[model samples]
Target: MEVVRSSIVLSRGRSRLTVTGVLTGLLLTLSVPAALPESGAVTPERGSAYMGMGVLAHDGIARGATADSLPDSRTGQTEGVDVSSYQRDVAWSTLYGSGVRWAYTKATEGTSYKNAYFTQQYTGSYDVGIVRGAYHFATPDSTGGAAQADYFVNHGGGWSADGKTLPGVLDIEWNPYGGDCYGKSKSQMVTWIRDFLNRYKARTGRAAVIYTATNWWTQCTGNYSGFGATNPLWIARYASTPGTLPAGWAYYTMWQYTSTGKTVGDHDRFNGGTTQLKTFASG
Candidate 1:
C-alpha cells in the first residue's frame, strides 16, 4: 500500500496533477463496490431467495421464448409454482383453481436466512389442496451443505407423510451475490451437494429434489450424473423446452419453465400428470 501510494505521489509531478486530485482518484479507484457487500454484512440482511432467484440473476435468461410458444409444453402436465419471502402472501387458492396442482416455497438459505413467508406460502398451498413442499436456496460458499441442510430442515424444510407435502427441494444454482460457482471447484461442488442431499434424505427419510439450470450445473459440478438416480431433477429453463438438461437425469421430474407467471408466482410443470404428482408427494 505504501509503495503504491509513493509511486502515485512520485507520478503526480510528472503527470502534473494536484496532490488532492491524485489522492482522491487513487482512493476512489481502490474502494470496494457498495452493491457487492461482504458476505458477513449481506447475510445479516436475511434477504429472500426464491427458486431460480440466483439462477435468473446470474445466468442469462433464454430470449425469444415463452412456455406457451411450445405446443407440447403444457399438454396434460400438472402445473405448480415456487415462492419465497419476496412473494409475501401468495394466492394459493387462485392458483389451485386455475389448474395448479403443486407448489414449493422457499424455506431457507445458507445457514443464516429463512423465508419469513414460508408458513403462509407452504401451509396455504396445502390448505388449497395443492401438493406443497419447501426448498432451501443453497450458498455453498457460506457453510457446509449438511449444516445448511440441517438448518433448512429445522426451519420448515422438513417433509411429512400427509401426502399433501412433497419432499424438500435443494435449490442449487448460480450464486447471485458473487462468483457463479460460489468459489468451489467442480469436484468440491459435487461433494458439497452430496453432503446436502445425503443429510436431507437422512433427516426426512426422502430424497430432496435438486433444482438447477443446466449451464450453471455444468460449470459448477462438471455435469455430475451420480445424483440423478437418488435426487429428482427440477430443471430451470425459461424457454419452451427444458433444452439440454444437466447430466445424470434421463428426464426432469419438474420443470420451472417460467419465472414470470400471471400473478401466481413462478410457474412450473410436473413432467407427469396429477396422478404422478400425487404419487411423488406420497413418496
Candidate 2:
C-alpha cells in the first residue's frame, strides 16, 4: 500500500551540482531498484485509510461506527475489522473482548507489494479466537488478474479448510490514483475481475470475497452483475444503512461501515450470525 521514494544530491568543487550532474545522479538513483520494506515495516500507502471521513460525508453520515454497537439493524450481526500496516501493534485480545469476532488483514497489493505485518496480525487475530482472513488490493491496470491472483496466493492470500479462516477478499474499489477506473474501459475492467476470481477459485477451491463501493463499482465496471452469484460481496458503504448494493447481489456478505471506528482498524459487520460466519469460513 506504500510507495517508496528516493532522492539524490551531487556537488562539484564547493559549488552546487549542475543541472546535468543532478539529472545524472537522479537517473542513477532511480536505476537502482527500490528495496521493499523489511518484515514488520510499514508500507508507504494505506489504501482507503485516510478517505474514511470523505466517504462517510458523501453518505451524509456524520458519525462513524462505534465499538459499543453494531452498525446495522440486522440481528446476530458479527463484528469484525480489516487492518493493514497502518494499524500498528494491535491488541487482538482486547478486540476480541470487545466483541470483534473476525478480522481480515491486508496480505498483498497489486502483484508485488506484501503487507509486512501480515504474519503477526493474522496470527495474533487468530490466536485470540478471531476468524482471520487475508485480502488483496487489486490493481487491475498494473497486471492481468490471473497473474495478480497467482502472486496473491503465492504470497499469503490462499485459504485453508480451517473453520476459523475466511476466504480471501479481493478489494476492487475506487482507485486512489487519479483515474477512477484505472483508465480501463468497463468491459476490460469486468474481464480483468472475472479473470482474477476464476483463477483464485481454481487455486483455492473457494470463491473470493469482492470488496467494492456502489459508486466505484458503477463507474468503473458499469455495475457488473456477473460475480455476485459466485463471489460474496463485501460492500463498502459508510452509512447507517448499507444503502443499495451493486448489481446482482441481493445482500452483502460483509458491510464495511466505517474506517474511523472505535476499533484499531476499519470496522465491519457480517450479515449473519456466528454459525453462518463459521460456515463461510469453512469453505
Candidate 3:
C-alpha cells in the first residue's frame, strides 16, 4: 500500500499502451489492454484506504507485534518475509541465517512499473535456499485486468514448476490515490479481479496467491467470496494473530504479521511447517 505518482493515458481500442514515470528508479512501458468493461453501474461512496501509504511511511508508529511473538517451529509454522525495492540491497545470507524460510519479492506494480531490485532479491533468496515467489501490485483502475495479467506474466511474475519457487502473487490492497476503492463499485472490483486471476491462471497453469487486508477486501469488494476456493490468501494484519479474514476464505495460507520486522523487511509466516511449505511452493 505504497503511494506512487503515476502518469497514465488511455486510448480507445482493444489494446492500450501506457508509459509510466520512473518510480523508485524503475521505469516501465506497458502495452496490454483488452476491451475494458466499464466500471459497475453503481458508484458507491468511496471507502477509507485500508493500508494507506501514509501509515506505512511512518515506521515509528508502534507495529503492535514483532517476529519474536510468532509461534516457534514446535508449533508447526515457518518464518518468511516479503520485500520491495524500498528494502534495497537485502542481506540474503543474514535473512536465511536468521531463520527466514521463504520470501516474496515485489516484481511489478500496475501495468507499467517493474521493481528494479526484483532480480537480485528473488535470486539471492533462492540461492540462500529460501522458497521464493514474485508478486505484482495491482492497479485495476488503470486498465483491464487481462491486460495487466499479460504484462505481469511477461515480466518476472511468471511461475515455474521448479519446487523452489511459489506461484505468483497478486497484491491488491489499498489504493494510494485519493479514492479509497479506486472508484470501482463492488461488482466492478470483482469483475476486474476475476479477469486478472483468470488470465494469470491460464498463463501459469496455477492460481495466483492473493495479498489483501480484511478491511480493504470487505469495503472494496463487498466481501466477495468467489476466489477463496482457488486462490490462496495472503492476509496482512499487524497484530499477533491474523484477526478476521475476508469472506470466502475459510483460512489464510500466509500471514504477513508485520512490516517493520527485526530481520530486514515485512515478516510473514506460512500456515504450516517446512514440508507443507515446500509442497505449497512446488505448485
Instruction: Give me the candidate number with maximum TM-score.
Output: 1
Residue clash pairs of candidate 3:
none
Error of 3 at 5 (Å): 21
Model 3: ten consecutive residues of lowest lDDT: 43-52
Off by over 4 Å in 1: 1-46, 66-73, 261-263
lDDT of 1 by residue, 1-283 (tens): 1123323421111111221211101210111112222455343143444566555554434666433352234576887878877568997777776677899988889998878888898889888898999989898999999999999999999988877889999999876567779899999999999999999989999999999999999989999999998889999886667899888899999998756422356668898888888888889
In the range 98-167, model 3's lDDT, one tens digit per residue, is: 7788998888767777777778999999999999998887777788889988888988988888889999
- What is the lDDT, from 0 to 100, of the residue 179 in candidate 1? 76
Q: At residue 263, give the lDDT of candidate 3.
A: 25
Which residue ranges in model 2 land beyond 4 Å of their true spot?
1-74, 261-263
TM-score list, all predictions = 0.81, 0.77, 0.77
TM-score of model 3 relative to the true fold? 0.77
What does candidate 2's lDDT look like per residue over 56-161, in tens digits?
Answer: 3233232453223324454778888888766656889878876789999888878778877888889999999999999988878789999999999998899999
Model 3 misplaced stretches (Cα beyond 4 Å): 1-74, 261-263
Q: Cα lDDT of all candidates, in order?
A: 0.74, 0.71, 0.70
